[model samples]
Target: MPDKKLQLDIRIIKFQDLIGRKPDKPFGYYGLGVQYMLSGKPNMADKLFTQALNIKPGYMPAILGKLEVLLAEKKLVSAARLYQKNRDLFSGKKIYKTRVQRITGSLYSGKFFYYYLKSIRSVFVFNETIGALQRMFNADRGNPVVNLLLAMFFLKEHKENERAFILYNLCVNMEGVPDKLRWDLVKVLAKDNPDILIDEKTAALFTTIPEGAVGEPYANFILKQFILLKDTDKINQAFAEFQKNHSFPDPKTMWQYIEFCRENDIWDSTVFACCQKLIDYGWIDRTIAETIVGLKNRKIIEYTRGMDKILSLYGYI
Candidate 1:
């Protein structure tokens, strides 16, 4: 049997070929084009996507696919033109506006950034996204979503630690950002930028900020609490309480657990737990797992070795 990746590629190729000849159903063409793109055959995918648009001039998925391909290729101007062309198609303009908003939306940006990094290999594009977010921040300083997106962009680009902290704090303090996203900022900052720990002054600034503050003042307080306490057990317990009392823990919570294990030199158990979680989520990647495992200390190795048996007993491996 072919490996999973190879089989996926074959299926994508077959889907593209089937749709290319028919050209009757816009969805088939769109789906096929996306499949081809996922399989790394963007040239063929672009042709199929264009064919879909020609068959159904106002179709969305195909147009978006074409724009994505252009963006992936670093043809930003072309992508912008395509977006503009299709921007007026939907009735009442609400539908089109909503689509644009969704794509550019703060909630969507984090997931978009992840896929953007995966799809494009160019550091230039990454830098451009960060720059765009920065410009947006300057113009709309009160926009919480923009602030959150900017923070995420900086994190992705490995920018100066202070910039990340500022962005993160803005997101956390910002009003009207769903509690879920604010929690995500906390997890990301805690794990990735622990070295740039929050200080008392920062905490105080957040406290005095009003409730309707676009960005809240509580973020620094939270960070300061973490720093001064320096109690990992307390932090974890608090996180557990937050998760239990509030809404469901998002993906970031899981990431925080993995990161916490890493920061305290608990590699083996961390890797094992991370591996088990990834496997459960169907995201197991041997190469990534092996690299993380290899980076652990001796004690971690021993602890993880014991965890291996525990996972096996539970059939989690």
Candidate 2:
């Protein structure tokens, strides 16, 4: 494989060639500008971005790119003026408006905070931003957008789980919160407090997870929670429900289910049927199938002998 620097150089050459051939194409200029920006040549990026805007005035992406360059250079006044000139493009977007408002407000109120917030996306120095957000939280604790942003910042950057959990809870409780955000909050909460997955308030959120890529995490979490609780009835019900929807369990969930069955001494048709499904789907190899057979027949020593291999296959070890 090509190294990272070589990959970047290849992209730069490709974008340069495309722009050379299509000098009038605004998107070509914009694309090359992005490549320049990624290569740490913001001055070159600024020139190409300006050329794009000159060709097609008010192009949103190019405008945003130029603004990014200005912000990166700490040219706050220019960035603010550019935003004001194109504020209509950001209309009807709550998040963008909130961010712009915060930056501008900080500019007038405190230059230190203004510069800190302005450089956040580039530098990611969270201490000043967190302090500013804390003051905002104190003033308007019910702001869902503020709560969500601060919660994510804490959860991802600071590893402040309790603080993040509190903010997530507050954000989800507010009216008009999106279902996707609510589901995300529930997932975070479920990781720390699995009991909440079975709560009445979160029942609707669990059902919002559709089948396929987006649903995998929720399904895995729900199945793992039932396994941890040793709630065979719930597991069976969930399995049946998922089957009805033609949604098969992921490999991780299957592993947890098999382990739960062994631990709970559930050597019935349910265990056999799930084992058959796992084998059929190629989720478990022949060795695990043999171990399952041993467990089914109550051959404790035989099953114990292969326990390490089984756990390793499932990534437990």
Candidate 3:
């Protein structure tokens, strides 16, 4: 079989052929839209989503897919506008509804700091950002988004490390992953010290990665947490879900998988299969790892041996 990337391409072609065969069905259009969206073609995804909606109006999947496209295209600039426009449609979702009323409603300069994290780079008014986020936390302490925003703010400022952990813990162990927890900031911090946000002792007790996004940074972080814990089952499950998305993990994630397998001293069929997929991804060449990583960070003998074994098995040696 072709690698996951090629498999996705084949599936996309099949989906398009299915759409051509049955133009009236919204399922084919919606499926194709998801494929396009995952492939980073939001414009085409949005058009296909619109087509799906035209075929079957009020289709929830199409609505949500279109919303994702909108979010990806405009980032958080359109979150408020989108929420306000679809208030009634979103009324049933308590967490998301509260999110709209709480954060997006009080955005600063077309950027909801909590919802639109990318805006942090341009945010010069630090005090105001703190005050706004704190007030949101005060208003709804249960809202993970509020906790996450505060955590991100502290994580960004890099002053209150302890305070950041407190909030980060709240987000991980929350009632449910109501808001899509963007772990971009946390991932950055974890790179140097993976123990900062999560440790092997506590990883098992924590909540699983919420299912929704695929080929996303947060999902990769969650998988890395499982890898840290040496829990191959959860690691396998995470990648399995990614596969089910028909898009699976990105190349950075694929690289991390092999590295983590080495770090943990565990290698199974998953690692063997993943090793075979170490092809050129245009942006990153998975074959080299840029080549067998640095020697200093080798964790266990099993991992080191497995690393070489898998790499050599796939002719990457």
How much lDDT does each candidate structure score?
0.54, 0.62, 0.58
Candidate 1 Cα errors over 4 Å, as ranges:
13-21, 77-85, 88-317
* lDDT per residue (tens digit) for residues 1-317 in model 1: 89878887787767767766775878777887887777778888898888887888878777767766775564544554455455455223555543433333333333665666677668887677666657766665544335655665565566647767777766554443443444555556667655323544333222221222212234324433543445565444444444344422233344444455556654544345445555456543433354345554354444455545544565544
State the lDDT of candidate 3 residue by residue for 1-317, as single tens digits: 68878877987999999999999999899999988877889999889889999999877667767666755654432433354456566666665544433332222223344544455565564555566656656655654435644664565456446656656666543332332343333454465556745443333432455456455555666666676676777777777777677755656667777777666665555554454455434332443442344331342122546556555566545
Model 2, C-alpha of 96: deviation from truth (Å) = 11
Model 1, C-alpha of 122: deviation from truth (Å): 14
Candidate 3: the clashing residue pairs are 288-291
TM-score of each: 0.37, 0.40, 0.41
Q: Which residue segments of model 2 deviate by more than 4 Å?
A: 67-252, 255-317
**Residue-pair clash count for candidate 2:** 0
Which is better, 2 or 3, measured by TM-score?
3
What's the distance in Å from true for residue 159, model 1?
Answer: 7.8
Residue pairs in clash, model 2: none
Give the worst 10-residue stretch by lDDT in candidate 2: 101-110
Q: Any runs in candidate 3 off by more than 4 Å, and if so which?
A: 54-58, 70-74, 80-150, 159-169, 175-202, 205-232, 235-317
